[model samples]
Target: MPLYWHLLKAVPSLQIIAHRIVWSALLVAGWLLWKYGRGWLRQTLAIPRAGWMLALSGTLIAFNWGLYIWAVNAGHVVETSLGYFINPLLNVVLGVAVLHERLNRVQWTAVAIASGGVLWLTANYGSFPWIALALAASFGSYGLIRKLVAVPPVRGLGVESLYLVLPALALLLWGESHGDGGFVAHGAVPAWGWGAAALLVFGGVLTALPLIGFADAVRRIPFSLVGLLQYIAPTLQLLCGVLVLGEAFDRDRAIGFAFIWVALAIYAVDGLLRNRAAPALPG
Candidate 1:
């Protein structure tokens, strides 16, 4: 985590995102090749009418990555963390509004509690938690888009990166011409190589891990429980920001977090009740 903080410090947001996407595309592509072969790549590339639909998702994902990287780089890691905590609720709202999925009473209550927390945060801060809001909104929208799309996750990511790769490469070339490249120009050899390799692996590993976990949790647990755990990353980021970086944690923000905690508690209890009432799965 400290490593990640330092890593964020070392590179610009777009550069970090580009590296992450490139490595993620490579790693996921390799996995697909091993599992399904080049035919999978061809199929992914040949999505006829779906191309534009995917381009939209790709754009949202790019913004999400950019915002997250900016938060990390700009010393707003805690606020960024808060944003992720809000994302599940955003996803639920999207489901209700766009997919026409109906929320249970308990789910509604949970959303209300979460909304109160957000309201409290906004009111106390005298402005919306823009960092958090941007992160949550962009990511929630990205998730919604991904859900609507028919392509497999790995293939979708690969295609998205492929679409963006030319622009990314152009940026790299453009940066080099301006003598502002993060790769060789930023630091010393050992620092650059090891750091670069770590970043590449970090990009690929993070892409795969939470997604795999979410897939498993979705099958084993209720959506609400999965939603609750979505707080973990943000919580960790908040802690790291405060303890590690010593960022400001003011009274209103503290109160705001308190509200969010209360809301999460309400959400958790409501989920437990819902789960108790839900029919048991087949043996």
Candidate 2:
């Protein structure tokens, strides 16, 4: 989270996003080589029948990163915060609309409350929180892609990033050769200092870790629980943005957030009831 905040503070969102995707690709590639060997890599990279879906997912992920970084750097942390809060609800909606998944009465109520919150925020701000909405959509779409792909998280990430790495590397090379490279060249904190470049690797590892944890959780826990915990990331972002980073928080934003929370609570209750009611699979 701080990585994103710091990056946005230092560079353009597109540049930061490009670096993130490139680094993630590299890190996952290394992991693939080590864990499953070249055979696994070959299998992972094997062009599948659904290659277009993977490509589209990559594009959506890129959009999510770019917008998020922009929001962070632009000091709209509050709105960025709201976006993540609403993400799970958005996902549920996607499940209903796109996948034709059924939501019970409780789930429906949660959606209504969340909808009300969004409307309240829009009414107050005189515009919808586009950043948050975009993030939710992008993330939801990425999830949909992953669902369609049905690969292990690590391997899936490897494949997705691998698809992206080629163009990313080409761009980096082109930028450097043309004297437009984004990397800093030299100094204590020198432009592209050893430490700075090193952070990219660390960033990749850091980025993958939480996702891995989440994946594990997904396997071990219920989806509703996973949905609730998803808020942790954005909540951290929101807190850091305001309390730690000292971004301003006004009454309207507070009210909007309050409404969103209420909606989420309603949504969570809905999910909990549905999960409890769900017929258990054979043990």
Candidate 3:
């Protein structure tokens, strides 16, 4: 995302998203065709149960991607960080509400502490963190839908890519016909530099790779752990904003982060205890 911010200096955010959809769909399509030959599309449609689920997931992830890309490029790097920071707690909340999953006292308390951290950040920022909230909500919903989806990771992603890119292709075509597009520019709107163009095409791979991992993880692991691990990406983003991008991180913000850390620690410890207590069965 930090890299995307640099790239966005030259490439438009919507264009980046368009290329992401187009290239990702092409790449995943090639892979599926190579391995499964002509049967891949049929396989995607074979599971009627997962079809609607995957479609919904595709829409959700697209929204999440578009928003994140815009947020990163718009100099809200730290705000994006807050969005991801809140994502896990939001996931916990969703698990309780959507999946009817119960949390232990410790885990529940962890969520409460995390909520406090969010509230503290909101107070310090002097307003409700709408961007953060939207990111968390959209992504958390994506995660929830994906859990119910039973498609294989690569194939599922391929299917989702197709859904996003078809519309993207239409948008690109519309822009090109008017002669003001990036990838297929004619006149009036000059094409991006070769370096930027190359990165734009490669955006597809960049976008799909993490999703492959996430699809696998959400299908296999407990969802809350998936949320917990999300801390890594946001933490890196926070560092990039403060250290690399040079965004201000005041003392009040530090206190807010401290609260989040405390919550994550409690959740981590609870997970450890539960794993240790569970009896191992024959594999």
lDDT of each: 0.69, 0.68, 0.82
Model 3 quality (TM-score) = 0.91
Evaluate residue 278 in candidate 1 and report its C-alpha lDDT on the 0 to 100 scale.
95
State in Å the error of residue 35, model 2: 2.3
> Evaluated with lDDT, which candidate comes out highest?
3
Best by TM-score: 3
Model 2, C-alpha of 276: deviation from truth (Å)? 7.0
User: TM-score-based ranking, best first?
Assistant: 3, 1, 2
Tens-digit lDDT string for candidate 1 (1-283): 4337456565666676666666666676687889898798678757664577668767877787777777777877777877888887786777678777677776687688777877777777655688788888877776666666667666776677667767767775665466555665553223576566466457757765555444344445434454577776777777888888898788877877776677778777776887799999999
Comparing 1 and 3 on TM-score, the stronger one: 3
Clashing residue pairs in candidate 1 are none
lDDT digits (tens) for residues 170-250 of candidate 2: 766665555444465322234555555566446666666665565455545444444566766777877888897788777
Cα-based TM-score, every candidate: 0.85, 0.83, 0.91
Give the Cα-based TM-score of candidate 2 against the true structure: 0.83
Residue 243 in candidate 3 has what lDDT? 92
List candidate 3 stretches off by more than 4 Å: 176-192, 277-283
lDDT of 2 at 143: 68
Give per-residue CA lDDT, model 3, range 1-283, as digits (tens): 6756466554556666777889999998899999999889788779767778878888888887788888777777888899999999888877778777788899889889988998999899766778888889888988887787778889998888887887988877776677655665623225554556677777788888888888889889778778789988988999888898788888989999989999999999899999999999989
Candidate 1 minimal-lDDT segment of 10 residues: 215-224
